[model samples]
Target: MKRRALLSSLAAGSVAALAGCNERGNATTGTTTHDDSTRTTTPTTSDAPTPPDTGLADATTAVFETRDRTISLLGGRRRLPSGLVMRAWLSATATADHPARVTATLTNDTEYETTLRLDEVPPFDTTPHASPGRDYDHTLYLAPTERHGFATTVPAVARAESGGWYLDGPPDRWQPEAVELAPGETLVGEFAVVPERPDSFPPGRYAFGYTDDPLTLSAWQSSQPGPTEESAFEDATPPAFAEQSPAWYHDATPETQAFLRPSAERVDAPAAVEFTLHNHRTEPLSGNVYDWTLYKQVEDDWYHIAPWAIPVPLTPLAPGDTHTWTFHAFSGPSVECENAVALGHLGGGRYAFHVNMSSESGPTHAALFDIDAPAVSVTPTEDVSVEREYRLVRASTPDDGGDRATLVVQRTDDADTRLLPEQVMRPRNRGLRNTLPFFEDGVQKVRLRTTDGVVDDALHGGEPERVFRYDGNAFAAWRA
Candidate 1:
């Protein structure tokens, strides 16, 4: 992305040649100053031919006359061949409370529609540097450096002080866009002049100027839209499991199957997987929380899958002791790392959980398993009776200080059932509302189950899931 380019043309002692001539045929000149006192010259009539009348209004008498202080136009407004007028102005005096301001406006005076490609409406200038000194009466005029684009010259009042004014830069994400103006339409922009240094800006006559590319008809017609920006994790790719695993674990030999193994060979996606590790060695085994890495097989290679919780220091397993561990599998990145890929939720695939033992000489162990597709299924049902199976129950009372409601999943059959975590619910075409799991279809029901017939209620506390019932009038919760 091309960030806003700074005003590189405002070098020391570089004067800005004012473009366009006023109605009186007087040309204005913008001189860059660094000294405490700046030299001023009277406006002189030029022999240059008069600029064509494009209905370009005089900014001084037209825009700034209402102000209490006097304001002068440097080169007057520039009227392009297409009748597009560009003008700028600055306040004559400034104080700490009301530092100063620069205003610029663009108007389309032609009968036909006009388009302009403006990266920035009012060009910004570099801060002026000059020490404060005795005030002196000096003439101030808004001058122009470049003809077409934003003005780049700092105002005379800003140049009169040791510390100049500060103006905010463009937003982090900005791009040039086409602005279409109908006949007689206008666009206005203002910049608040603030002192760069904490001290107040010395009171004095001030002038400002604008310089930018000319808004030509060719430039407007040829303008194309810029590329759109993507979010941080939008295009993230999953990282390889072996690349993220510890080098020591990859080099160690596989342990005997009896010491470490998964509870089942296959489990449903987006559900928890369980594993058992036995300390068969004569000594206790110790390791840290991050001693394990979970990987999912993609083709012949394995990619890393992030866990739900942060790793903690592991407790030492005494000889002949057994430890069981459970991990919730879902989609997305849990840990922040460079090139970290976020997998939304686990899909049907082969997976392996590798664990590293505390003993340096101990063999590493890996328990392989297969993740079946999520057991939840959604189908449309015309039967209104099915709606009674789901309800929206108030999870908290008003006295409890929380008025939140929860989705309650009622069992239509006698068989025991389990509801996967909210993260596991994936809607096909629309967003999934966790509290109101019901969708556009009035009787949409989801059947969720795990491989071992064990309910993992760690997240929902073994409570039946609840879903909202949207009636024609409004959404209401019903109890059966």
Candidate 2:
């Protein structure tokens, strides 16, 4: 029989074996029946008849043994179809006033040994909310009667969607490593979650489970002793990027000096900041133009602002070559291009532009600049309520001919709103009579400035006008 078919049969048997087991309190035991004379007897709970002398019985035995060890490590009373036992409970350290620490345990209940291959450092990890792409890829070995546990501390709030279970934050791509669990031995791993508002968290009973299914056949196939070779079940590892010392570039026959700098020391928000890369080396400098990254400095830390897309091919810059790039200040839209790098907007602050030189670990060149607020300002005549959505309009006259303006909407309550650049808008007509949506539920302000600095008074000194305000149920126009 094919390996996949054999695994399917084993999985079915395991599920059948766990049908009547209780999930809450005590461990469940299952007995295996063997017939030596024919070597073809079927498991009591499985619907599929066991074929004679195909090693199905032996594989089933190994799976049962492996599950036994898993149960021992996890203290799991509940059985899973993947031939594993698991349990989740709140730790003693958790309290009503503090974040809850939830722990999940898995045990190996068998007298034999088994191994687990995982995609991450810890064999088991979960996200606070459901995520579709969670997967595993690291290796772990478990001896008979051994157990392993994973614990995470999350907010005390319960999730009705997950049946009152509190999960941890998103998974991190940590370096992978292997671990071993000996018989009757226990290993515990811990992870931390970012705490939510203190008032939002309340004490409650919650369960925990891995984001990815831990009982899949690929998780236990290596540990099963059967005709199938373990190597056949292994996944191919991705190739690692080449790394070189920084001095390698300097030591080259024709030394290359590549540096990035902004066109100006200070740029206005809603405007474009042009960056220039000058290659002052005897040899041609080759690198990917899309490898550039934009970083914003907050206090003492630099946070990376990811680009939407990156061009794939390498670009070669000859001696005395200069390349120019532009990023919209304050998160404005970019001019569309096939090879253009779509960058996020920048707010008023200190920023650095970095570009990779040769390889993944190659040295990077960076330039720094600052952004200042635009000249225009939006002042509200009355208090802006958070529950209402207002529309911004500019009162235009016949005398206002062929003039354009850019309106900037800023949220006063959130400083990080600058990271997202939807606040900038350029009205198309010269009169600037078009209305723009201001639907976000927050205390916000608007600034109106000329598309070009030449039209300074385009949107200012306008007459009283009527605009609509939405209050969840309906929209009402009020004259100001």
Candidate 3:
């Protein structure tokens, strides 16, 4: 019984880890940590971009902002920890149409100059000739240098990234290279990852997102041996990213109750924030990144400090039919400035969050209106009466997602609701596999909240939800 219980608990933890961004909290060992670079306060003569209304407002268009800080380009993953984004675009078919160029530039983001040696090497092996055929997983044409592989060291200053940040090539193409990023300068390089075998494969085929770090054996599943990230809880952490400088904190007392829905007793406060994106524009909405900014209310007009960001490469949000991009961020005073999850999207924008503390490089774009919408609350089921063997409540959604939509089930028999699972179910949209768990004998009020936003394009949508009741035996047949 004890063994089974422990295994069941760990299984649940692992599932929670896989759902959100790859945090050190995923595994019991791997811990990923980053340095906190939030500045105290810079003397600003002028550089603040005023918020503008772009007329793309939906009922979900609530304004939120947070504390601004500096983030490292590399040394970041679960998703790219380094901040340098690498995109892979291939020809439609396996037939080589575009020139294959495998190029890479190592920038020196330091004070001195640096050199980078880009080599095409296989993984290390106990025997001399056996390495190539073993260790590495994917098979493409490439050479090997050095006994093991290739190496380079580039010395440069801060903010210096190499230009043309890419590698272009046909098969037989892995070569290592490096560059120097000068002080306050960046060295970016790019080539083509065009495989020699193009149309021979197929059109609109598999090209990028092949692997997070396929170049090196990064994950244990892939035979890569790097330190994993640390855990969010402190027990089961990830490997590479561990407890670094910029540490985070949390709180659940009365101070933050004014914002988030307060629980009667102490409980976990994890927020499942999803982006309800509808690309109403002509172009296929996407870019090197899909940055989802979660704003906490800070000042009156300034909003709050930025604590959580849903950073991922979103797929091409086809023409119509809204797609929801989901992510989970734990909310407590320790990990945030306040208790609020306001999401925003930055697609095809010129400026990245490239702000420096000392005032050398600062300020970027001033978006007039939000391209994405705010998350709308779904209505609770209504009416309660006794019936047959099973008791239930219908799922309510602006889109009528029906019984399938996943919900964070909160069972409250107490008008003064107290202890219960902070987050019972993860909010997922797999098309109506959802069934609310009810245990009370009398009428029980059940609430179902949508994990993602509702883009009504119109502001006031009447409380953004419906309500229903759950009887002892079955749910009433009704629609909100």
Candidate 4:
């Protein structure tokens, strides 16, 4: 399937709510100010003043509370050179009698396609962004003066534990990664700032910012000091893919599958491509002037497929800039049988995927990548009663192992288990639980037997799809 076709569904579901902002109400005699960056509050006559409107009226100030609530610290939008619009706002919330909580949201306006970088940490990280984690490590407070040392002391916040393969080794060692957004795509990320501790938040103006803790700053600085002159995309010319690169291929081996099969789930569509984009020019470049088109090489001919484009705007790059681009054939695990039909994943051999780029001025292209596959032995299960093989692709368990595979459960008298090439099986991701509930409880070695009745395909009544029963289980027969 073409990249564009593969990502079309994502585009359809990317709408984000931009309301609930700029809500206004009376402060009940509390202080109200109109400063661009300052919040307004009026002292209530009663020590137990009535709660002000929870709906924040302005970008800055709101009623102070020991409980958790979202307070706007700042709000604004930036228009980039690529015609993409960027919106950012800071909000504060805290649990009851807990330390104040703060978060920044950076959104891509729904008007155009754009890309946003999410991999940077503070000081060097972009504004209107919150760090990732269960608890934020930095404290946010207003200071009597600016530059009280952007330095911060790392708090006693424990490092969060996680499962799965993280490309940058540890969470602290993460590198920058970018997301392509369809029009109106909104991403909200939260981090722990001024954790719920006694000294986490000191008396101050309490604007939307983290503490200048030295330890915290040091760790983030070492990890991501922002995109440096050497890191920005630098290419004064057209962008092209590198030569002889296998953009998409199966990285799993038999041993890895054996180790992962019992422990992790697999994804229906597991095709992945890793290739570098090289800028062949002498000047820095930005913007999406080139149109991307994907193709599959069948036999000797190159067939066209749609390309996946980020609905968001692109950032500028420096000359001679080259960066790796990882593309997944499917956005997530395929949950239905029809997804296979859409992907056209039958009869596989040396099929290769190529990404081609074109511009109104001219065509500049490269072979994005390709994959070679072994033939799948499509045959009936052993039992004479149940004819069709239940060769469903498994959704990947993203937590432990980072790859996907299809567990070929051969139901013949001498039941056999084999790990087939994932793509050969269609994306049937109707939640693995629905198809293989036993998978969650651990693999069940139940016997397969043919049932007496036959049924029509769910969609096409005339078509033949087989249904079988497990000798050990008492549920209705399953369709294959």
Best by TM-score: 2
Candidate 1 Cα deviation (angstroms), residue 464: 46
State the weakest 10-residue window (summed lDDT) of model 2.
Answer: 66-75
Worst 10 residues of 3 by lDDT: 63-72
lDDT minimum window of 10 residues, candidate 4: 256-265
**TM-score-sorted candidate list, best first:** 2, 1, 4, 3
Overall local distance difference test of candidate 3 = 0.22
Off by over 4 Å in 3: 1-106, 115-170, 177-190, 204-282, 286-480
lDDT of 2 by residue, 1-480 (tens): 243345444433422333233222212112222222111111122321222121111111111121211010111134444334344322212112212222334444444443432332122432322111231122121101101122222112322221222222223322122223333332332222112221222211112234342221111121321212122112322121123123211122222344554556567665566666654432345677777766666565555555434777866544333467766654444455443444323456766666665423345555566677532222221222222335443322222355454444332222221221212222221212222234334424333333332222222234232122222212222122
TM-score to true structure, per model: 0.24, 0.26, 0.22, 0.23
Estimate, for each residue in 1-480, the C-alpha lDDT of model 3 and write its tens digit: 342244334323422322122222210121112231211112121211111111221100100011111000111112123332222111011111111212222223345533322221111111111111232333222111111112221111111022111112222222233322333333222122211222111111121122432332110111111113331232312111111111111111222111111111122234343333322221223322244332221112222123323445533322111234343334321233233343222111111111111111211111111122222222222432223233444344444453332232333332321111111111221111133444345424333333233211011132332222322232221112
All candidates' lDDT scores?
Answer: 0.36, 0.33, 0.22, 0.27
Count of backbone collisions within predicted model 2 = 25
The TM-score, computed over Cα atoms with residue i paired to residue i, of candidate 3 is 0.22
Regions more than 4 Å wrong, model 1: 1-258, 270-272, 308-314, 328-344, 374-480
Where is model 2 more than 4 Å wrong at Cα?
A: 1-256, 330-345, 359-362, 374-480
What does the lDDT read for residue 264 in candidate 4? 11
